[model samples]
Target: MATAKTEKLSASLEDYLEAIYNLSVDGSVARSKNIAQALEVSRASVTGALRILAEKQLVNYKPYGYITLTKQGCIEAQRVVRKHNIIEKFFVDVLGVEHTVAQKAACEAEHAFGPQIVEKLLCFIEFVNSYNKNGYDLHDEFRSFFRKHGSIAAGDSN
Candidate 1:
Protein backbone atom coordinates (compact mmCIF):
# COMPACT_ATOMS: atom_id res chain seq x y z
CA MET A 1 0.00 0.00 0.00
CA ALA A 2 1.28 3.39 -0.88
CA THR A 3 1.43 5.96 1.85
CA ALA A 4 -0.08 9.37 1.34
CA LYS A 5 3.40 10.81 1.39
CA THR A 6 4.58 8.45 -1.29
CA GLU A 7 1.44 8.82 -3.34
CA LYS A 8 1.92 12.55 -3.44
CA LEU A 9 5.52 12.33 -4.58
CA SER A 10 6.46 12.89 -8.21
CA ALA A 11 8.76 10.42 -9.95
CA SER A 12 11.59 12.91 -9.69
CA LEU A 13 11.15 13.14 -5.94
CA GLU A 14 11.01 9.40 -5.65
CA ASP A 15 14.32 9.21 -7.51
CA TYR A 16 15.80 11.64 -5.06
CA LEU A 17 14.54 9.58 -2.15
CA GLU A 18 15.99 6.42 -3.68
CA ALA A 19 19.31 8.14 -4.24
CA ILE A 20 19.41 9.28 -0.64
CA TYR A 21 18.53 5.84 0.64
CA ASN A 22 21.29 4.25 -1.45
CA LEU A 23 23.83 6.86 -0.42
CA SER A 24 22.98 6.49 3.23
CA VAL A 25 23.34 2.71 3.02
CA ASP A 26 27.06 3.21 3.71
CA GLY A 27 26.13 4.63 7.13
CA SER A 28 26.60 8.19 6.05
CA VAL A 29 24.00 10.74 5.16
CA ALA A 30 23.77 12.07 1.59
CA ARG A 31 24.93 15.50 0.62
CA SER A 32 23.36 17.71 -2.03
CA LYS A 33 26.37 17.45 -4.31
CA ASN A 34 26.34 13.68 -4.02
CA ILE A 35 22.65 13.55 -4.77
CA ALA A 36 23.22 15.76 -7.79
CA GLN A 37 26.00 13.51 -8.98
CA ALA A 38 23.94 10.37 -8.46
CA LEU A 39 20.95 11.65 -10.36
CA GLU A 40 22.98 13.60 -12.92
CA VAL A 41 20.97 16.68 -12.11
CA SER A 42 22.25 20.09 -11.23
CA ARG A 43 22.88 21.14 -7.64
CA ALA A 44 20.06 23.67 -7.94
CA SER A 45 17.71 20.94 -9.06
CA VAL A 46 18.78 18.79 -6.16
CA THR A 47 18.16 21.68 -3.77
CA GLY A 48 14.71 22.21 -5.16
CA ALA A 49 13.83 18.53 -4.92
CA LEU A 50 15.27 18.36 -1.41
CA ARG A 51 13.15 21.30 -0.34
CA ILE A 52 10.04 19.66 -1.67
CA LEU A 53 10.93 16.38 -0.01
CA ALA A 54 11.58 18.17 3.25
CA GLU A 55 8.19 19.87 3.06
CA LYS A 56 6.60 16.49 2.59
CA GLN A 57 8.38 15.24 5.70
CA LEU A 58 10.20 12.70 3.60
CA VAL A 59 13.71 13.90 4.40
CA ASN A 60 15.75 15.56 7.09
CA TYR A 61 17.33 18.40 5.19
CA LYS A 62 19.20 21.55 6.16
CA PRO A 63 20.96 23.80 3.74
CA TYR A 64 24.53 22.57 3.21
CA GLY A 65 23.92 19.76 5.71
CA TYR A 66 23.92 16.04 5.03
CA ILE A 67 20.46 14.72 4.21
CA THR A 68 18.77 11.68 5.63
CA LEU A 69 15.47 9.92 5.09
CA THR A 70 12.73 10.15 7.66
CA LYS A 71 11.07 6.86 8.60
CA GLN A 72 8.29 7.35 6.09
CA GLY A 73 10.84 8.38 3.49
CA CYS A 74 12.82 5.20 4.03
CA ILE A 75 9.71 3.09 3.55
CA GLU A 76 8.84 4.89 0.36
CA ALA A 77 12.40 4.72 -0.88
CA GLN A 78 12.49 1.02 -0.16
CA ARG A 79 9.34 0.57 -2.18
CA VAL A 80 10.88 2.36 -5.15
CA VAL A 81 14.14 0.48 -4.85
CA ARG A 82 12.35 -2.84 -4.60
CA LYS A 83 10.40 -2.13 -7.74
CA HIS A 84 13.57 -1.19 -9.59
CA ASN A 85 15.42 -4.29 -8.44
CA ILE A 86 12.59 -6.63 -9.34
CA ILE A 87 12.20 -5.15 -12.78
CA GLU A 88 15.93 -5.13 -13.40
CA LYS A 89 16.26 -8.71 -12.30
CA PHE A 90 13.40 -9.76 -14.53
CA PHE A 91 14.93 -8.01 -17.52
CA VAL A 92 18.43 -9.32 -16.94
CA ASP A 93 17.78 -12.80 -15.60
CA VAL A 94 14.60 -13.72 -17.41
CA LEU A 95 14.83 -11.77 -20.64
CA GLY A 96 18.62 -11.78 -20.95
CA VAL A 97 18.85 -8.04 -21.28
CA GLU A 98 22.25 -6.42 -20.88
CA HIS A 99 22.84 -5.13 -17.38
CA THR A 100 23.30 -1.53 -18.48
CA VAL A 101 20.18 -1.59 -20.63
CA ALA A 102 18.21 -3.29 -17.87
CA GLN A 103 19.36 -0.71 -15.38
CA LYS A 104 18.21 2.16 -17.58
CA ALA A 105 14.93 0.47 -18.38
CA ALA A 106 14.30 -0.33 -14.73
CA CYS A 107 14.88 3.27 -13.72
CA GLU A 108 12.16 4.40 -16.09
CA ALA A 109 9.81 1.54 -15.32
CA GLU A 110 10.07 1.58 -11.53
CA HIS A 111 7.85 4.63 -11.18
CA ALA A 112 5.21 3.40 -13.62
CA PHE A 113 4.40 0.02 -12.07
CA GLY A 114 2.16 -0.29 -9.02
CA PRO A 115 2.52 -2.67 -6.13
CA GLN A 116 0.33 -5.37 -7.68
CA ILE A 117 2.26 -5.49 -10.94
CA VAL A 118 5.59 -5.36 -9.15
CA GLU A 119 4.54 -8.22 -6.91
CA LYS A 120 3.50 -10.27 -9.91
CA LEU A 121 6.82 -9.62 -11.60
CA LEU A 122 8.66 -10.69 -8.46
CA CYS A 123 6.61 -13.86 -8.33
CA PHE A 124 7.32 -14.50 -11.99
CA ILE A 125 11.05 -14.11 -11.35
CA GLU A 126 10.77 -16.58 -8.47
CA PHE A 127 8.97 -19.01 -10.75
CA VAL A 128 11.70 -18.66 -13.35
CA ASN A 129 14.36 -19.16 -10.70
CA SER A 130 12.62 -22.30 -9.50
CA TYR A 131 12.46 -23.61 -13.03
CA ASN A 132 16.19 -23.02 -13.48
CA LYS A 133 16.94 -24.70 -10.17
CA ASN A 134 14.94 -27.73 -11.29
CA GLY A 135 17.11 -28.04 -14.43
CA TYR A 136 14.57 -26.48 -16.78
CA ASP A 137 16.74 -23.56 -17.92
CA LEU A 138 13.91 -21.42 -19.28
CA HIS A 139 16.22 -18.50 -19.90
CA ASP A 140 18.48 -20.50 -22.20
CA GLU A 141 15.52 -22.09 -23.94
CA PHE A 142 13.97 -18.70 -24.60
CA ARG A 143 17.22 -17.33 -25.96
CA SER A 144 17.59 -20.24 -28.33
CA PHE A 145 13.99 -19.93 -29.41
CA PHE A 146 14.42 -16.22 -30.05
CA ARG A 147 17.55 -16.83 -32.03
CA LYS A 148 15.72 -19.26 -34.28
CA HIS A 149 12.33 -17.61 -34.65
CA GLY A 150 13.18 -13.94 -33.99
CA SER A 151 9.90 -13.62 -32.08
CA ILE A 152 7.16 -15.72 -30.60
CA ALA A 153 3.77 -15.77 -32.19
CA ALA A 154 0.50 -17.53 -31.71
CA GLY A 155 0.69 -21.27 -32.30
CA ASP A 156 4.46 -21.21 -32.57
CA SER A 157 6.01 -24.62 -31.94
CA ASN A 158 9.46 -25.70 -30.76
Candidate 2:
Protein backbone atom coordinates (compact mmCIF):
# COMPACT_ATOMS: atom_id res chain seq x y z
CA MET A 1 0.00 0.00 0.00
CA ALA A 2 1.12 3.60 -0.60
CA THR A 3 1.66 5.84 2.40
CA ALA A 4 -1.18 7.94 3.85
CA LYS A 5 0.12 11.01 1.98
CA THR A 6 -0.36 9.29 -1.36
CA GLU A 7 -3.85 8.22 -0.31
CA LYS A 8 -4.60 11.91 0.04
CA LEU A 9 -4.72 12.04 -3.77
CA SER A 10 -8.17 11.99 -5.33
CA ALA A 11 -8.57 10.14 -8.61
CA SER A 12 -9.17 13.41 -10.46
CA LEU A 13 -5.99 14.93 -9.12
CA GLU A 14 -4.01 11.87 -10.11
CA ASP A 15 -5.52 11.93 -13.58
CA TYR A 16 -4.58 15.57 -14.10
CA LEU A 17 -1.09 14.96 -12.82
CA GLU A 18 -0.68 12.07 -15.22
CA ALA A 19 -1.94 14.07 -18.17
CA ILE A 20 0.50 16.88 -17.56
CA TYR A 21 3.36 14.49 -16.98
CA ASN A 22 2.68 12.64 -20.23
CA LEU A 23 2.39 15.83 -22.26
CA SER A 24 5.46 17.35 -20.71
CA VAL A 25 7.45 14.26 -21.62
CA ASP A 26 7.79 15.45 -25.21
CA GLY A 27 7.32 19.13 -24.63
CA SER A 28 8.37 21.90 -22.30
CA VAL A 29 5.03 22.47 -20.60
CA ALA A 30 1.37 21.40 -20.52
CA ARG A 31 -1.60 23.56 -21.23
CA SER A 32 -4.59 23.33 -18.92
CA LYS A 33 -7.15 22.85 -21.71
CA ASN A 34 -5.17 19.96 -23.12
CA ILE A 35 -5.15 18.30 -19.73
CA ALA A 36 -8.87 18.91 -19.47
CA GLN A 37 -9.48 17.33 -22.85
CA ALA A 38 -7.39 14.31 -22.01
CA LEU A 39 -9.31 13.78 -18.78
CA GLU A 40 -12.68 14.74 -20.34
CA VAL A 41 -13.23 17.40 -17.76
CA SER A 42 -14.07 21.04 -18.39
CA ARG A 43 -11.47 23.81 -18.34
CA ALA A 44 -12.94 25.22 -15.14
CA SER A 45 -12.55 21.88 -13.41
CA VAL A 46 -8.97 21.67 -14.63
CA THR A 47 -8.21 25.04 -13.11
CA GLY A 48 -9.72 24.02 -9.81
CA ALA A 49 -7.84 20.76 -9.78
CA LEU A 50 -4.61 22.56 -10.58
CA ARG A 51 -5.26 24.84 -7.64
CA ILE A 52 -5.48 21.85 -5.31
CA LEU A 53 -2.36 20.27 -6.77
CA ALA A 54 -0.44 23.54 -6.35
CA GLU A 55 -1.41 23.61 -2.70
CA LYS A 56 -0.11 20.06 -2.37
CA GLN A 57 3.23 21.09 -3.93
CA LEU A 58 2.62 18.84 -6.92
CA VAL A 59 2.46 21.44 -9.64
CA ASN A 60 3.37 24.95 -10.70
CA TYR A 61 0.23 26.55 -12.13
CA LYS A 62 -0.16 30.00 -13.65
CA PRO A 63 -3.46 31.34 -14.90
CA TYR A 64 -3.55 31.74 -18.70
CA GLY A 65 -0.10 30.15 -18.69
CA TYR A 66 1.08 26.55 -18.31
CA ILE A 67 1.54 23.74 -15.79
CA THR A 68 4.53 21.63 -14.82
CA LEU A 69 5.00 18.92 -12.24
CA THR A 70 7.47 19.35 -9.42
CA LYS A 71 10.19 16.68 -9.20
CA GLN A 72 8.44 14.90 -6.36
CA GLY A 73 5.12 15.21 -8.18
CA CYS A 74 6.63 13.73 -11.33
CA ILE A 75 7.88 10.69 -9.41
CA GLU A 76 4.54 10.20 -7.72
CA ALA A 77 2.63 10.57 -10.97
CA GLN A 78 4.88 8.06 -12.68
CA ARG A 79 4.24 5.50 -9.93
CA VAL A 80 0.50 6.07 -10.11
CA VAL A 81 0.51 5.83 -13.88
CA ARG A 82 2.46 2.58 -13.70
CA LYS A 83 -0.15 1.18 -11.34
CA HIS A 84 -2.89 2.17 -13.80
CA ASN A 85 -1.09 0.45 -16.66
CA ILE A 86 -0.50 -2.65 -14.56
CA ILE A 87 -4.19 -2.87 -13.71
CA GLU A 88 -5.16 -2.46 -17.35
CA LYS A 89 -2.86 -5.30 -18.34
CA PHE A 90 -4.33 -7.49 -15.59
CA PHE A 91 -7.89 -6.90 -16.79
CA VAL A 92 -7.02 -7.57 -20.42
CA ASP A 93 -4.65 -10.54 -20.01
CA VAL A 94 -5.90 -12.20 -16.80
CA LEU A 95 -9.63 -11.46 -17.02
CA GLY A 96 -9.72 -11.38 -20.86
CA VAL A 97 -11.50 -8.05 -20.87
CA GLU A 98 -11.43 -5.72 -23.86
CA HIS A 99 -8.74 -3.06 -24.08
CA THR A 100 -10.90 0.07 -23.95
CA VAL A 101 -13.03 -1.18 -21.07
CA ALA A 102 -9.94 -2.33 -19.24
CA GLN A 103 -8.42 1.13 -19.52
CA LYS A 104 -11.43 2.76 -17.89
CA ALA A 105 -11.84 0.06 -15.26
CA ALA A 106 -8.15 0.20 -14.42
CA CYS A 107 -8.38 3.94 -13.96
CA GLU A 108 -10.97 3.31 -11.27
CA ALA A 109 -9.19 0.35 -9.66
CA GLU A 110 -5.59 1.64 -9.51
CA HIS A 111 -6.24 3.83 -6.50
CA ALA A 112 -7.99 1.14 -4.49
CA PHE A 113 -5.71 -1.79 -5.44
CA GLY A 114 -2.39 -1.63 -3.62
CA PRO A 115 0.99 -1.97 -5.35
CA GLN A 116 1.47 -5.45 -3.83
CA ILE A 117 -1.66 -6.67 -5.63
CA VAL A 118 -0.54 -4.92 -8.80
CA GLU A 119 2.81 -6.71 -8.54
CA LYS A 120 1.01 -10.03 -8.20
CA LEU A 121 -1.07 -9.12 -11.22
CA LEU A 122 2.08 -8.32 -13.18
CA CYS A 123 3.44 -11.79 -12.39
CA PHE A 124 0.14 -13.37 -13.38
CA ILE A 125 0.25 -11.53 -16.69
CA GLU A 126 3.75 -12.83 -17.38
CA PHE A 127 2.66 -16.37 -16.46
CA VAL A 128 -0.25 -16.14 -18.89
CA ASN A 129 1.93 -14.74 -21.63
CA SER A 130 4.20 -17.77 -21.33
CA TYR A 131 1.57 -19.69 -23.31
CA ASN A 132 0.99 -16.93 -25.86
CA LYS A 133 3.25 -18.34 -28.53
CA ASN A 134 1.25 -21.58 -28.37
CA GLY A 135 -1.76 -19.58 -29.62
CA TYR A 136 -4.27 -19.71 -26.75
CA ASP A 137 -6.68 -17.37 -25.05
CA LEU A 138 -7.61 -18.23 -21.49
CA HIS A 139 -11.23 -17.24 -22.05
CA ASP A 140 -12.00 -19.32 -25.13
CA GLU A 141 -15.11 -21.39 -24.40
CA PHE A 142 -15.02 -19.86 -20.94
CA ARG A 143 -18.71 -18.99 -20.73
CA SER A 144 -20.02 -22.40 -21.71
CA PHE A 145 -17.68 -24.22 -19.35
CA PHE A 146 -18.59 -21.91 -16.50
CA ARG A 147 -22.28 -22.42 -17.16
CA LYS A 148 -21.94 -26.20 -17.22
CA HIS A 149 -19.46 -26.70 -14.37
CA GLY A 150 -20.20 -23.61 -12.27
CA SER A 151 -17.85 -20.66 -11.78
CA ILE A 152 -14.94 -22.83 -10.71
CA ALA A 153 -14.82 -24.51 -14.10
CA ALA A 154 -12.12 -26.90 -15.22
CA GLY A 155 -9.30 -25.37 -17.27
CA ASP A 156 -10.20 -21.92 -15.91
CA SER A 157 -6.59 -20.77 -15.66
CA ASN A 158 -5.25 -22.27 -18.86
Candidate 3:
Protein backbone atom coordinates (compact mmCIF):
# COMPACT_ATOMS: atom_id res chain seq x y z
CA MET A 1 0.00 0.00 0.00
CA ALA A 2 2.86 2.33 0.78
CA THR A 3 4.97 1.06 -2.09
CA ALA A 4 4.48 3.91 -4.57
CA LYS A 5 7.21 5.97 -2.95
CA THR A 6 9.02 2.88 -1.71
CA GLU A 7 9.70 1.83 -5.28
CA LYS A 8 12.00 4.79 -5.59
CA LEU A 9 14.14 3.87 -2.59
CA SER A 10 17.69 2.86 -3.37
CA ALA A 11 18.94 -0.45 -2.03
CA SER A 12 20.87 1.34 0.69
CA LEU A 13 17.79 3.25 1.74
CA GLU A 14 15.83 0.04 1.74
CA ASP A 15 18.45 -1.46 4.03
CA TYR A 16 18.16 1.48 6.37
CA LEU A 17 14.40 1.17 6.38
CA GLU A 18 14.57 -2.51 7.14
CA ALA A 19 17.06 -1.97 9.92
CA ILE A 20 14.87 0.68 11.46
CA TYR A 21 11.84 -1.59 11.27
CA ASN A 22 13.68 -4.43 12.94
CA LEU A 23 14.96 -2.22 15.69
CA SER A 24 11.59 -0.70 16.31
CA VAL A 25 9.73 -4.00 16.39
CA ASP A 26 9.73 -3.99 20.19
CA GLY A 27 7.94 -0.66 20.21
CA SER A 28 10.99 1.09 21.51
CA VAL A 29 12.25 4.35 20.16
CA ALA A 30 14.80 4.02 17.36
CA ARG A 31 17.52 6.58 17.92
CA SER A 32 20.05 7.59 15.29
CA LYS A 33 22.87 6.04 17.24
CA ASN A 34 21.02 2.71 17.40
CA ILE A 35 20.27 2.86 13.71
CA ALA A 36 23.89 3.59 12.95
CA GLN A 37 24.99 0.68 15.13
CA ALA A 38 22.49 -1.67 13.58
CA LEU A 39 23.57 -0.70 10.07
CA GLU A 40 27.27 -0.46 10.86
CA VAL A 41 27.24 3.00 9.38
CA SER A 42 28.42 6.26 10.87
CA ARG A 43 25.96 8.54 12.67
CA ALA A 44 26.46 11.13 9.92
CA SER A 45 25.41 8.52 7.37
CA VAL A 46 22.31 7.64 9.37
CA THR A 47 21.47 11.32 9.62
CA GLY A 48 21.69 11.71 5.88
CA ALA A 49 19.56 8.65 5.23
CA LEU A 50 16.99 9.79 7.76
CA ARG A 51 16.79 13.18 6.04
CA ILE A 52 16.14 11.58 2.68
CA LEU A 53 13.55 9.24 4.16
CA ALA A 54 11.88 12.17 5.88
CA GLU A 55 11.70 14.06 2.57
CA LYS A 56 9.96 11.04 1.03
CA GLN A 57 7.48 11.09 3.94
CA LEU A 58 8.68 7.65 4.94
CA VAL A 59 10.14 8.66 8.29
CA ASN A 60 9.50 11.22 10.97
CA TYR A 61 12.85 12.69 11.86
CA LYS A 62 13.77 15.74 13.89
CA PRO A 63 17.39 16.49 14.51
CA TYR A 64 18.28 15.17 18.00
CA GLY A 65 14.85 13.62 18.23
CA TYR A 66 13.86 9.95 18.02
CA ILE A 67 13.30 8.64 14.51
CA THR A 68 10.18 6.72 13.68
CA LEU A 69 8.71 5.25 10.53
CA THR A 70 5.75 6.94 9.04
CA LYS A 71 2.90 4.51 8.39
CA GLN A 72 4.07 4.27 4.77
CA GLY A 73 7.60 3.62 5.88
CA CYS A 74 6.52 0.81 8.16
CA ILE A 75 4.60 -0.83 5.37
CA GLU A 76 7.52 -0.63 2.99
CA ALA A 77 9.92 -1.93 5.62
CA GLN A 78 7.67 -4.89 6.32
CA ARG A 79 7.61 -5.63 2.61
CA VAL A 80 11.38 -5.84 2.56
CA VAL A 81 11.34 -8.03 5.65
CA ARG A 82 8.81 -10.37 4.04
CA LYS A 83 10.89 -10.70 0.91
CA HIS A 84 13.95 -11.57 2.95
CA ASN A 85 12.05 -14.22 4.86
CA ILE A 86 10.59 -15.78 1.74
CA ILE A 87 13.93 -15.90 -0.02
CA GLU A 88 15.64 -17.42 3.00
CA LYS A 89 12.99 -20.09 3.28
CA PHE A 90 13.18 -20.87 -0.44
CA PHE A 91 16.91 -21.31 -0.28
CA VAL A 92 17.02 -23.39 2.87
CA ASP A 93 13.87 -25.48 2.42
CA VAL A 94 13.71 -25.91 -1.35
CA LEU A 95 17.36 -25.73 -2.35
CA GLY A 96 18.83 -27.39 0.75
CA VAL A 97 21.16 -24.45 1.25
CA GLU A 98 22.63 -24.05 4.70
CA HIS A 99 20.78 -21.67 6.99
CA THR A 100 23.58 -19.10 7.37
CA VAL A 101 24.37 -19.16 3.68
CA ALA A 102 20.71 -18.86 2.82
CA GLN A 103 20.33 -15.84 5.09
CA LYS A 104 23.23 -14.03 3.43
CA ALA A 105 22.04 -15.00 -0.02
CA ALA A 106 18.49 -13.93 0.76
CA CYS A 107 19.64 -10.46 1.83
CA GLU A 108 21.29 -9.95 -1.55
CA ALA A 109 18.41 -11.49 -3.50
CA GLU A 110 15.51 -9.71 -1.73
CA HIS A 111 16.63 -6.46 -3.36
CA ALA A 112 17.40 -7.98 -6.74
CA PHE A 113 14.14 -9.70 -7.74
CA GLY A 114 11.07 -7.80 -8.82
CA PRO A 115 7.54 -8.38 -7.60
CA GLN A 116 6.44 -10.74 -10.38
CA ILE A 117 9.29 -13.13 -9.82
CA VAL A 118 8.78 -12.99 -6.07
CA GLU A 119 5.09 -13.74 -6.45
CA LYS A 120 5.79 -16.70 -8.69
CA LEU A 121 8.35 -18.00 -6.24
CA LEU A 122 5.89 -17.67 -3.39
CA CYS A 123 3.27 -19.58 -5.35
CA PHE A 124 5.75 -22.25 -6.26
CA ILE A 125 6.82 -22.62 -2.65
CA GLU A 126 3.25 -22.92 -1.48
CA PHE A 127 2.51 -25.53 -4.11
CA VAL A 128 5.53 -27.53 -3.11
CA ASN A 129 4.56 -27.29 0.54
CA SER A 130 1.01 -28.42 -0.15
CA TYR A 131 2.24 -31.25 -2.31
CA ASN A 132 4.54 -32.48 0.42
CA LYS A 133 1.90 -32.10 3.10
CA ASN A 134 -0.41 -34.34 1.12
CA GLY A 135 2.05 -37.23 1.19
CA TYR A 136 3.64 -36.41 -2.15
CA ASP A 137 7.44 -36.70 -2.37
CA LEU A 138 8.46 -33.89 -4.69
CA HIS A 139 10.59 -32.17 -2.08
CA ASP A 140 12.91 -35.13 -1.63
CA GLU A 141 13.01 -35.83 -5.35
CA PHE A 142 13.93 -32.27 -6.19
CA ARG A 143 16.54 -32.05 -3.50
CA SER A 144 18.12 -35.31 -4.58
CA PHE A 145 18.13 -34.28 -8.19
CA PHE A 146 19.68 -30.93 -7.40
CA ARG A 147 22.36 -32.55 -5.30
CA LYS A 148 23.17 -34.89 -8.12
CA HIS A 149 23.06 -32.45 -11.01
CA GLY A 150 23.06 -28.81 -9.90
CA SER A 151 20.80 -26.45 -11.89
CA ILE A 152 19.03 -27.91 -14.88
CA ALA A 153 20.25 -26.96 -18.32
CA ALA A 154 18.51 -26.66 -21.65
CA GLY A 155 18.91 -29.51 -24.14
CA ASP A 156 20.87 -31.57 -21.69
CA SER A 157 21.62 -35.18 -22.66
CA ASN A 158 20.35 -37.10 -19.61
Candidate 4:
Protein backbone atom coordinates (compact mmCIF):
# COMPACT_ATOMS: atom_id res chain seq x y z
CA MET A 1 0.00 0.00 0.00
CA ALA A 2 1.23 3.46 -0.83
CA THR A 3 1.43 6.07 1.89
CA ALA A 4 -0.01 9.50 1.08
CA LYS A 5 3.39 11.17 0.82
CA THR A 6 4.86 8.30 -1.17
CA GLU A 7 1.98 8.48 -3.59
CA LYS A 8 2.70 12.13 -4.29
CA LEU A 9 6.46 11.75 -4.80
CA SER A 10 8.49 10.61 -7.75
CA ALA A 11 12.27 10.13 -7.82
CA SER A 12 12.72 12.92 -10.34
CA LEU A 13 10.45 15.29 -8.44
CA GLU A 14 12.20 14.52 -5.16
CA ASP A 15 15.58 15.24 -6.68
CA TYR A 16 14.52 18.65 -7.88
CA LEU A 17 12.86 19.44 -4.59
CA GLU A 18 15.91 18.39 -2.62
CA ALA A 19 18.18 20.38 -4.89
CA ILE A 20 16.08 23.47 -4.40
CA TYR A 21 16.00 22.91 -0.67
CA ASN A 22 19.81 22.75 -0.52
CA LEU A 23 20.27 25.77 -2.74
CA SER A 24 17.70 27.72 -0.77
CA VAL A 25 19.58 27.12 2.48
CA ASP A 26 22.20 29.85 1.86
CA GLY A 27 19.81 32.17 0.07
CA SER A 28 16.15 32.93 -0.41
CA VAL A 29 15.96 31.88 -4.04
CA ALA A 30 17.32 28.89 -5.98
CA ARG A 31 18.80 29.40 -9.40
CA SER A 32 18.10 26.89 -12.15
CA LYS A 33 21.80 26.63 -12.92
CA ASN A 34 22.57 25.63 -9.36
CA ILE A 35 19.90 22.95 -9.44
CA ALA A 36 20.95 21.62 -12.81
CA GLN A 37 24.59 21.37 -11.73
CA ALA A 38 23.74 19.82 -8.39
CA LEU A 39 21.58 17.14 -9.99
CA GLU A 40 23.81 16.73 -13.06
CA VAL A 41 20.71 17.18 -15.17
CA SER A 42 20.23 19.36 -18.19
CA ARG A 43 18.89 22.87 -17.69
CA ALA A 44 16.02 22.01 -20.00
CA SER A 45 15.08 19.06 -17.83
CA VAL A 46 15.16 21.22 -14.75
CA THR A 47 12.88 23.69 -16.42
CA GLY A 48 10.34 21.00 -17.22
CA ALA A 49 10.37 19.67 -13.67
CA LEU A 50 10.07 23.17 -12.29
CA ARG A 51 6.96 23.69 -14.40
CA ILE A 52 5.44 20.57 -12.98
CA LEU A 53 6.31 21.58 -9.42
CA ALA A 54 4.83 25.01 -9.97
CA GLU A 55 1.62 23.50 -11.26
CA LYS A 56 1.43 21.38 -8.12
CA GLN A 57 1.95 24.48 -5.99
CA LEU A 58 5.14 23.03 -4.57
CA VAL A 59 7.19 25.89 -5.89
CA ASN A 60 6.85 29.33 -7.34
CA TYR A 61 8.42 29.41 -10.81
CA LYS A 62 8.57 32.53 -12.88
CA PRO A 63 10.28 32.43 -16.25
CA TYR A 64 14.00 33.26 -15.89
CA GLY A 65 13.47 34.15 -12.28
CA TYR A 66 14.83 32.32 -9.23
CA ILE A 67 12.76 29.44 -7.90
CA THR A 68 11.55 29.10 -4.35
CA LEU A 69 9.83 26.24 -2.60
CA THR A 70 6.39 26.61 -1.12
CA LYS A 71 5.84 25.46 2.48
CA GLN A 72 4.69 22.00 1.37
CA GLY A 73 7.71 21.73 -0.90
CA CYS A 74 10.10 22.45 1.94
CA ILE A 75 8.59 19.73 4.08
CA GLU A 76 8.88 17.15 1.31
CA ALA A 77 12.39 18.25 0.42
CA GLN A 78 13.57 17.86 4.01
CA ARG A 79 12.30 14.29 4.05
CA VAL A 80 14.02 13.49 0.77
CA VAL A 81 17.30 14.99 1.98
CA ARG A 82 17.12 13.01 5.18
CA LYS A 83 16.54 9.80 3.25
CA HIS A 84 19.38 10.55 0.85
CA ASN A 85 21.84 11.27 3.64
CA ILE A 86 20.91 8.22 5.67
CA ILE A 87 21.15 5.93 2.66
CA GLU A 88 24.53 7.37 1.73
CA LYS A 89 25.85 6.76 5.23
CA PHE A 90 24.59 3.19 5.21
CA PHE A 91 26.18 2.41 1.86
CA VAL A 92 29.52 4.03 2.68
CA ASP A 93 29.98 3.10 6.32
CA VAL A 94 28.10 -0.15 6.57
CA LEU A 95 28.37 -1.56 3.05
CA GLY A 96 32.04 -0.61 2.63
CA VAL A 97 31.36 1.02 -0.72
CA GLU A 98 33.45 3.90 -2.03
CA HIS A 99 32.05 7.32 -1.20
CA THR A 100 31.05 8.18 -4.75
CA VAL A 101 29.53 4.77 -5.34
CA ALA A 102 27.66 5.08 -2.08
CA GLN A 103 26.27 8.42 -3.12
CA LYS A 104 24.91 7.01 -6.39
CA ALA A 105 23.52 4.03 -4.55
CA ALA A 106 21.86 6.40 -2.11
CA CYS A 107 20.10 8.24 -4.93
CA GLU A 108 18.45 4.97 -5.88
CA ALA A 109 17.90 3.76 -2.33
CA GLU A 110 16.15 6.84 -0.98
CA HIS A 111 13.10 6.07 -3.07
CA ALA A 112 12.85 2.45 -2.02
CA PHE A 113 12.54 3.21 1.66
CA GLY A 114 9.32 4.64 3.01
CA PRO A 115 9.28 6.86 6.05
CA GLN A 116 9.05 4.01 8.57
CA ILE A 117 11.94 2.05 7.10
CA VAL A 118 13.99 5.20 6.70
CA GLU A 119 13.68 6.01 10.37
CA LYS A 120 14.70 2.46 11.32
CA LEU A 121 17.74 2.72 9.06
CA LEU A 122 18.65 6.08 10.62
CA CYS A 123 18.59 4.53 14.07
CA PHE A 124 20.66 1.57 12.93
CA ILE A 125 23.34 3.85 11.52
CA GLU A 126 23.42 5.92 14.69
CA PHE A 127 23.95 2.77 16.73
CA VAL A 128 26.67 1.56 14.39
CA ASN A 129 28.45 4.91 14.37
CA SER A 130 28.54 4.99 18.16
CA TYR A 131 31.13 2.24 18.55
CA ASN A 132 32.53 1.03 15.28
CA LYS A 133 35.40 2.19 13.13
CA ASN A 134 35.44 -0.92 10.97
CA GLY A 135 33.73 0.91 8.08
CA TYR A 136 32.76 -1.69 5.44
CA ASP A 137 33.29 -4.78 7.54
CA LEU A 138 30.44 -3.73 9.79
CA HIS A 139 27.88 -4.45 7.10
CA ASP A 140 29.28 -7.90 6.52
CA GLU A 141 29.14 -8.56 10.26
CA PHE A 142 25.52 -7.49 10.36
CA ARG A 143 24.58 -9.75 7.47
CA SER A 144 26.35 -12.65 9.08
CA PHE A 145 24.58 -12.03 12.36
CA PHE A 146 21.20 -11.83 10.68
CA ARG A 147 21.81 -15.04 8.75
CA LYS A 148 22.69 -16.83 11.95
CA HIS A 149 19.76 -15.58 14.00
CA GLY A 150 16.98 -14.50 11.63
CA SER A 151 15.29 -17.37 9.88
CA ILE A 152 12.18 -17.38 7.76
CA ALA A 153 9.15 -18.86 9.40
CA ALA A 154 8.16 -22.31 8.20
CA GLY A 155 4.94 -21.10 6.61
CA ASP A 156 6.53 -18.13 4.83
CA SER A 157 6.38 -18.28 1.02
CA ASN A 158 9.16 -17.65 -1.40
Whole-model lDDT per candidate: 0.87, 0.79, 0.85, 0.82
Model 3 over residues 47-141: C-alpha lDDT tens digits? 99999999888899888887899989998999999998888889888877778888878887889988898889888888877785557677898
Q: Relative to the unseen true structure, what is the C-alpha lDDT of residue 33 in candidate 3, on a scale of 0 to 100?
A: 89
Tens digits of per-residue lDDT for model 2 on 8-119? 6877788888888888888667888788888898989989998888877788777776688887789889988899988898887666666887888888888898778888
Q: What CA RMSD would you report for each candidate?
A: 5.7, 6.5, 5.7, 8.5
Position 105, candidate 3: lDDT: 80
At residue 84, give the lDDT of candidate 3. Answer: 88
Q: What 10-residue stretch in candidate 2 is worst by lDDT?
A: 149-158
* Count: clashes, candidate 3: 0
Error of 1 at 25 (Å): 1.1
Clashing pairs in 3: none
Q: What's the CA RMSD of model 4 in angstroms?
A: 8.5
> lDDT per residue, candidate 1, 53-78, as tens digits?
98888998888776889888999999
TM-score, candidate number 1: 0.87
> Which order, best to worst by TM-score?
1, 3, 2, 4
Estimate the overall C-alpha local distance difference test score of candidate 1.
0.87
lDDT (Cα, tens digit) per residue for candidate 4, span 32-112? 988999999999999999998987778888998769998888889998998999999888776555687788878888888
Error of 3 at 37 (Å): 2.4
